[model samples]
Target chain A: MTNTLTDYISGYMDTINQQLEQFVYSLQVPERLRDSMLYSIQAGGKRIRPILLLMACEAYGGSPNRALPVGCAVEMVHTYSLIHDDLPAMDNDDVRRGMPTNHKKFDDATAILAGDGLLTASFFAITNHDLLQDEEKVYLSRELSKASGAEGMVAGQMLDMEAENQELTVEKLEQIHKHKTGELLRFSAVAGAYIGGANQSQLQSIEKYARHLGLLFQVQDDILDIIGDEEEMGKPVGSDETNQKSTYPQLLGLQGAIDKRDYYANQAKEALKEAGVDSTLLEEFIDYIQHRKK
Target chain B: MTNTLTDYISGYMDTINQQLEQFVYSLQVPERLRDSMLYSIQAGGKRIRPILLLMACEAYGGSPNRALPVGCAVEMVHTYSLIHDDLPAMDNDDVRRGMPTNHKKFDDATAILAGDGLLTASFFAITNHDLLQDEEKVYLSRELSKASGAEGMVAGQMLDMEAENQELTVEKLEQIHKHKTGELLRFSAVAGAYIGGANQSQLQSIEKYARHLGLLFQVQDDILDIIGDEEEMGKPVGSDETNQKSTYPQLLGLQGAIDKRDYYANQAKEALKEAGVDSTLLEEFIDYIQHRKK
Candidate 1:
């Protein structure tokens, strides 16, 4: 079952990655900028956001192919954020995905524009997809903007910068991560539900699941930053601490962090239960986040 | 009459600027990122893009206020490009709108994030607006995305980057500027028409006008870069020459550039005439662009 799930998810990811590359290429990006964008995207993260989006769509009885555009859109938004985050002004990290960051590989301006390009491309993807209704497309596009913009990831990033060198409570940390990272996750699930024609109540349930799943995803990330090997993680470890940034492992002890992860994981499963839909794949994803080493 | 037109455009801009500031603030932008975005937006340009969009809408008998969100959206996208363009990797300019650029004022990372935030917020603004039918909103959103994304402004920018220090002919320069700078201008007009429920022929006429207007806009900009006063322009003159960037004035002599501006300006007015709409405001604006100092 685990292997089958992996195969299913991987197959979906491959389709998404392929279609996404084609979309990016169709933009006719100049050689240099194109190279920079491809550098980060092709650097090989797990395509976690896209996978979640596709899974949510599938769970709601939508074809993964139909959902592929949204999957690509979410990942584009995610990759764009990562490019900007790795800039000299933000995380200022020299490496990501075990390769030189976009800014490091290209110039900062190109990296900045590449991020802008990706973010802008995401809107086009969601809006241009022919299979979705106008209302569905508009709603998804709106939700995406809410997730990626100031009130969402950008605001969270601002808070993260300010909170650096200062201690933060668990609640504050959650607030930061929820916006910086969680909002997009919520958008992915809710958008999938929307495009799949899920009812309002069903969407609400998916939101609950996404909310918890997003929190757990970040927590696991924090844990990995501490415990995972640098080679496997593909970026420097303990840099979060080195930068004086707050994290779950910092607020909660190692054991406390694990407990929190379990708490959220259970909450996610409960939300799925409320959804009253078969979300076995989503459940497995939650479990995977809790257990993944890298 | 000129004063009345100026008042009309300026009043509309003042409303948009106020609304833009408010809309951005509504997102809970982190203090740092918020400061960066506000600094660029409030730094003050001519507000030409918004004014053009408003005039187009008004020309078609659409309420300017109803079109205000689209105005703000284009300006946000424009401001984002300027922010990213000033980064060390791109144009490396130290100033814009008479103020230090975002990267200089904040940091490279903050500037990049601010640009990212602003770009995402553009679409968010359009989607969240109350005016327009659901179908219209979706169409509007898609058009704006195409204008801003890889196929449009991004490609233009990529071309700009590639052409630097290379031998670019007048035709290539026009092609690059058409997408890089003109596409959004075209969008501003098209968006207004879309909001106004323009018929196909009306839209085509506006498209023709916009293409010519954009060409004239760029030629004038290039002319200003060479001959305009530093104090009047609010940035150092001749930076384009210093950077060895290609422009109309570079490819064509000064006299030729001026002639091109006039030719395109006349063509734009003619297109407006062909549209059979009230051309009073648009005509005045076109004349203003032909002779304006900044």
Candidate 2:
């Protein structure tokens, strides 16, 4: 946790939060729906996705200014997924990020609409972005739709629900997370690289880095669910065990999961090195994901 | 309707339904999730939206083949909206188009995922379509997002939910439908025209046509809900009245609503005439919307 790295993240987090708030508030939507959408955006997460997007863009020697709105767009989609995942019919969680979930705060209908609004607006955000070329916008939309839709996060969600109370082999578990988290994370890196004018080869290297990082994130998340501090996580731990849901820890042992997480972290660093990207911040991210309490 | 318009519609309808099925079935998604999506898409409506898109494209001198996939994309979004609207937390509908709703056939979670999948894939479909220019794809994606997102359909859905069981003046009611049905209808015509290479002036006239056509669709919908035959509509009539939902017929007397419908139809026809379009098919559409039993 170098002060410089920490400072960098904090600075971008503040900017991301501010811009996201402005973006949602400025929408010409029903006031109540806008509020619900803004509420979740403001309900704090680490803004890891958007920050990663910006860092990846910078690593490719592009200006962060160009990536800013695109980063926010990814965050919007991510927020929508979380809100829907917390619905009574889904994960049924009443709290997220230390606050009442959108459904709990505004009711299921509002939360649903809010999620819909956010997801639906994200493509517009990208295409309507003035800084990017029209062709760049097309690529982003195509990749984004893949990352968020049936082929990606949503499919992962559906499979995860089906897997609840059922045994999942390690292969099946990895398959789930690859789509669930890996694809979006992959998009964060690859999209940034493309927008940064990286050639196809550079984009491929970044994709490799992101795939490993995504697994590292999920493995750590699974392990943290077993032993994470309740106060730090803002929710009770051991939820996976309670729900009879499979995790890397459950499928393998806890120590085994820890070993896998480190392996992914190392693999991610190697990919960054192979690409010869500006790896200082991404290397720190490897450490941060490896050791973060939440 | 003239035989030319009738034959034209039936011919395109077959191709639309066929390609839509192929598109959904071809996705490399989970079998169950894909099936759920296919179920709703195959659960027939009149394929009105896609057909309108095709007709508008042809009217503006575009080939139907080029507009085919984009039309499918619009229909996919429309279908997804219906699936989400039928959820237990939303409309709680049991049947649509004479078949069980997506949520009824599948569980709530699967239905949600299917809707999410369809909505998300639509952008990909547009961007991935080979026939359209990059510029056209960008235009369609931008318009689709606005039409489907917070500024449009989702906002309308949220407002309609809020207005449920509450008194709404005709102005408020029109505002809701304009956002709800209006934007998407506008997209169909406008996107088709753009892809067909219609100039700015032609596009504006089509926009006007679509605006009136959207209201005509809604007004007729209200009338059908009150007096439509169950067999003809393929669902029970009076459900809106049963739900105590606001409708044009409720806001205005039945005769007033009928007058409104005819007026909008006339206005839509005038717009088409002003656009100097090949208006034979669209003229039939205005009539079909006005007098269709369903």
Candidate 3:
């Protein structure tokens, strides 16, 4: 099942990568800025956000190709956030995805503009997806915006920045994670279901699944940041500790964080069962999220 | 004619301002960021881009209300650019429109996120506009994307940044200005006319008019940067000089820049005549672009 999930995800990513190249090729970005956006986005990663959206759509009986635009859009939003996060003004990271971060390769201005360009372009990609009906296209575009904007990812980022060096209660930390990482992840599943024309009950199930999956995903990240090897993660470990950011590991002890991750992963699996999604791919997804080394 | 244009433009602005306020209110941006976005956006500048769109639609025999979304969209895109341009990595300006810039009022990260949220939200707003048919809405969204993306505003900005302190010819300067300031302006007229369901020939005429009007608008802006009073302009005088950026007044003599503005204005007026648009509002627009003081 794990192998099957890997094969399915890799296939979807290849297709998505091709489409991304085509979409970006149509734009005549300055060579410098273009290279910067391409460097960060094109550097290989798991492509989990887009894959989740595709899988969610397929689970709802929609063609993955039909949901490709939303897939691309979620990835674009994720990429833009990563680019901005790596900027000196933000997280100030020097490496990402085993390569120099965008700001490291390009000047600060080009990196900033590249992030801006990618962020703006996500809507263009979603709205321009030719397969969806006009109304459906509009709906998905709005959903995508809601996921990325002030009430969502941006708000989450603000909380993360503010919470640095300050002790945060569990509730405050959960709210921050929910917005920062969970909103986009939730949107990935929900938008896929929406674009795939899932009914209300099915959507609710997918939403439930996505919510816990997101929490589990972040908790795993917290664990990895604290103890994972730098080579496997492709960056220095313990930077989170050095930065004094609030994390599951910090809020809960290491063992407590692992326990919470298991609870959320179990909840995620239960939600999928409630949704009646029959794919073995989903079970494999649960296993992968919980046990991945990187 | 200029007085007539001012009246027409201001009336359109008054209506659009209400919609702009509603959009900002709907964002539920954190109170601080909301204030930051609203501060510069609501600050009193002529709503030239949006009003131009409405006038063009009106000239093409469409209802001005039908163009409202497009009007507001261009303004949103314009406002986003302003917000980002004032960031510490870019112009690093402390003020705009007689108030502290978004970054100055809020922190740099919030300002960046606000600009990004606004940028992404523009397409969402265009897609969600209730007035247009599904097809028209799709087309309008596509056009806005083309105008705002890397080949348009983003690319234009890159060129502008790269040209600073470099010897830029008139042609390079025109290319930069066209993408930076003119693409959105051109899209305003073109999009409004398209929404009005203009025939192909009429669309062509409006496109020509928009092209000339957009360049004329920039030429006048360049002129004002050199000679306009700081009180009226709401920024320091000779900012282009202060920034060591290239501009029309630098490439051409002051008289030459003035002559070029008049030439483009005349061409704009001629295009409207060729389109056989009976809009007195559009006729006056040419005059305003040619000689307005602020």
Please name the candidate that would achieve the greatest TM-score relative to the true structure.
2
RMSD of each: 1.9, 1.0, 1.8
> In what order do the candidates fall by DockQ, top score first?
2, 1, 3
TM-score of chain A of each: 0.97, 0.98, 0.96
lDDT of 3 by residue, B1-294 (tens): 566776776666678999887888888666776776677668757888888888778777788878887788789889989888878788789978778888877788777777877777787687777778877877777778778887789888888888888988999998998899889988998888887778889888988898898899999999999889899777887888888988888888899999999999889888888886776888788887787788
Given the true complex, what DockQ would model 3 score? 0.65
Across residues B104-193, which tens digit of lDDT does each residue of candidate 2 receive? Answer: 998888898899999998999999999888888888999999999999999989989999989999899999999888988999989888
What count of clashes does model 3 give? Answer: 0
Note the DockQ of each predicted structure: 0.74, 0.89, 0.65
The global C-alpha lDDT for each of the candidates, from Candidate 1 onward, is 0.85, 0.90, 0.82
Give one digit per residue, the lDDT tens place, for model 1 in A67-106: 8898899899899889888777777889877788888888
Model 3: lDDT equals 0.82
Better of 2 and 3 by TM-score: 2
Q: Model 3, chain B: what is the TM-score?
A: 0.96
Candidate 1 lDDT, B157-181, residue by residue in tens: 8788878899888899999989988
Question: Could you estimate the TM-score for every candidate?
Answer: 0.96, 0.99, 0.96
In order of the candidates, what TM-score does chain B achieve? 0.97, 0.98, 0.96
Worst 10 residues of 2 chain A by lDDT: A273-282
- Give the TM-score comparing model 1 with the true structure, all chains together: 0.96
Is candidate 2 or 3 superior in lDDT? 2
